[model samples]
Target chain A: MDLVKVQLTNSEFLSTGIEKLDNLLEGGILKGFTTLILGSPGSSIEILSKQLAVKGKVLYVTTDETEQEVMDAITRFGWKPEHIEFTDIATKYSKSVLSREKKRVSIYEQRSKLKLKELIEIGSSGVMPAVKAQEDFLAIFSNSAKTTSPEKIILNSLDFFLSMYSQEEVLRTLHAAKVANIERAGVLFIIMTKGIHGEVFERKMEGMADCVLELNVIQKGSTFERFLAVKKMRNYAKKIGIARYAIDSDGFVLEMIERIM
Target chain B: MTNSESYVYNQNRIGLNENENAKSSCPCITGIDELDQKLGGGLPSGNTVLLVGSSGSGKTTLSMQFLTNGAKIGERGVFFTITEPLFKLTKNLEKFDFYDKKMIESGMVNLIDLRIISERLGLDAEKYTVEDASALLEILKDIADELDVKRLIIDSITALCYRLQTKEMIRDFIFKLGSSLASMNCTTILTSEVPPNEVKYSQYGIEEFIADGIIFLGDVDRKGDLIRTLQVIKMRGTNHSRTKSAMSISSKNGIELTPLLKSRV
Candidate 1:
């Protein structure tokens, strides 16, 4: 099926809150586009992405951090938890798959404990099969979009997802998210840490994204320099150089460090 | 008995008799018994031990062995990489039998790359910058708290010195790192690169002063064949064997150390 691309006006662009980055992004990130934020360890992508969540109605899908941790981060940024709804896959996966009690208790067995009507509505399950879990995980966002209709969706760090699921399965799910983004005229921000996966896997994921932003941290002397480079963006005029920034108590503040051309 | 079996038996002497001896320094083992015996009974818990050696002197392999072994008994570890990227370190570690992909996957072993942070801050020349050191300490604390890490390895404190090139900055960094590790009750191994023939235990001569113990790794010529050797220079709070011992790296065993030599002094 042909995906419907939303024509976004300048005002419709999703602001990243950091005016310097927003200016570089041509007002802000384009609506209905799937953007990938790639970084290595200590790149501060989480801080940058948290800043972006405040810009629009965000459905934050976390696979690395716990709900409390995400909430703490949001609060630290002076943003309210009410502003962003979360889909906590990491916690759910840990409790369902990693917990011994849950593993020992069969889903069918759990269903027998529940009433017939309850089983019919909620399904006879304690833990879902791997494939089914992936399906439901994707479905949560789709079903929520029908009701709440979030303007922006953030999948924090696709690295954990890749680790848990097969690349093909993850790619299939990402495709569904992409189609969903186009249909809703909303944006999807996929977080992926660079250097965690092989070149082939990274290249394949990059091919699926509408925009790719690479965040890097370089050591100069005793200080850490952070740079943001827009590697790929569809239709938008690309920025010439990287943006230098620092994370402090107030949030991400662009520094005066010289940009790498 | 075979040499390897005898080595195993010698190391297990402390472990097999743990119940009977009631050892005062119930140290956390590096998983290599021969090396552990050299440092009394493993490194005293909650101490910062520095492993100083030249590049390719098996500094990383030894430290990785320490963390991977701790990870085996469900003790979590965090490797803060300043010189190497997490990807390269993990990839390099995969060749060793002790390297467990599951440990990393399950968050039992966490590798945080700080090289970029140092690079971004322009931390190159010898400069006394407490701010940079504090910022780094905060990051380490955050990870340590989050992971509840027991075994911590900062592979190559040499890179930190290279960035904070001044003696003062390196000294301050080591002091702060040492105290913090102690406060957290975490057993840490801080590795550094030194000139191959340098008699000093560390690059700056201050790392030895700040650390709780020092392990020096180097190459020695044995009948024209170069052989790696490790020696416990000093370990506070315990009676340790202060003698040079044969050290070798193996894909199967990770880090192997000969039983400590008879004390000369």
Candidate 2:
């Protein structure tokens, strides 16, 4: 069966707070487009993602850092935090696969609550024994998969599953989750990663995204500097390559003196 | 002010509740019999206490005990510290099993990170005296308002008064601090350090005057054995025994105030 594809011809996106960069990327990056952000350890990708996240329901997937550390990083951004709520979905799950062993205890407890009579009645009725009840339990347990549309999503790093499995298995499931999160769900999927095949990964992400932004932090005698690149915007000639920028108490500031021919 | 020649008189009395909410549902047991008695049964509910002491003088221990007792009796507690980093605080308190482990999860006992505010300050420290005590007092008031705190202790008023040099200013800070705590209706304890050789009085006159009570803790050398002592110097609106009691500190039992100070000097 073919999944219905409802494509918006003139798709739009928000370069978050960067104005000229956004112009280069057509209005903004299209919603539901999965963009890849590559940066160093001190890169403010987390900051930018959090700034965009606070306004909507954001599901942050992180493997590189602790939940509290990430929260602390974003807190410095001075975002009004009334509407934003956080949850740590990293715990209580088998990162190797989508298996939850903790549910065994609760399942036993629910099974104990049931008597032999109820099981036999369903069995005699030719109804699938405990099928509905198992479904109910599964519904309660499977929370991470519940895609909340009309929200922004921040996937901090795919490096989390590194310890649990081979890169192939991780990349497969992760890319699938990212695609499902973007295509089936209406959200701005900002997936972040680092290392060797970064450009390859970015190119693959570009294939699946509407806009791509690369952040670089370099040292220039006595001080630190940052750069942003808008690699591709489907409908726009988005700003490409490194641009001069500034940073302060709030966040990154950029300037682009480009050819206006 | 000289002890005999000087007497503290309360003026304006600008801060203090009718305390209609006095002793409201504070089921906390301080584990110390004497201090509990002096507090009119474990620090009146909703009061804030400032605990002042140098680095290893049992400031955190005292506050932890207050919270431990609360956690035991199903009362809620929160500890907000700015002096030390968080990892150290957790590592230090790991020995006290009495601090209910479940409190952090259930939100019964929480720790607010004020390091963010403290870390961002510009250097070249300013004097912390009575004149400027209002700023710190406002911070305390904000904490109480935000968290619905019942009992609080600020470890060192000495830290607060370090910046301020004037005794009158220190006194004003103590007065406003105590008054604001009273207004919030929290049973508070503000700790301040007095040089061991110095007389036993809160640095500022306002400490005793504005407070419903005062407790003095010190180290007394009895035959080369440094014994800790605690005395309930004054407890207004209550009949508290004026006793310079013997006290001891144990890892398991934080501070034990023995009521055998009947032999007055």
For lDDT, the strongest prediction is: 1
Question: Model 2, stretches more than 4 Å misplaced?
Answer: A1-261, B1-31, B38-40, B46-57, B112-115, B118-125, B128-136, B164-172, B204-206, B261-265
The complex in candidate 1 yields a DockQ of: 0.01
For each candidate, the alpha-carbon lDDT, in order, equals: 0.73, 0.53
What does the lDDT come to for candidate 2? 0.53
The interface root mean square deviation of candidate 1 comes to: 21.6
- Backbone clashes, each candidate: 23, 33
lDDT of 1 by residue, B1-265 (tens): 8999998886676555443324443577888978776765578878899998888989999988889888898889877776665667877999999898888778787776655433323332244266656656655665575568888988778767766757788888888877887777788899978888777787777888889888889877756766788988887776677778888789999899885444333
lDDT of 2 by residue, B1-265 (tens): 5654332221111112213224254323465666765554555544434443344656677777777676666655656554555456666777775555577657566564333322111111344434234444454555555556556665455655565577777667667666775666656666666566455455554455555656666666666766666666665544445666687767676677776544333
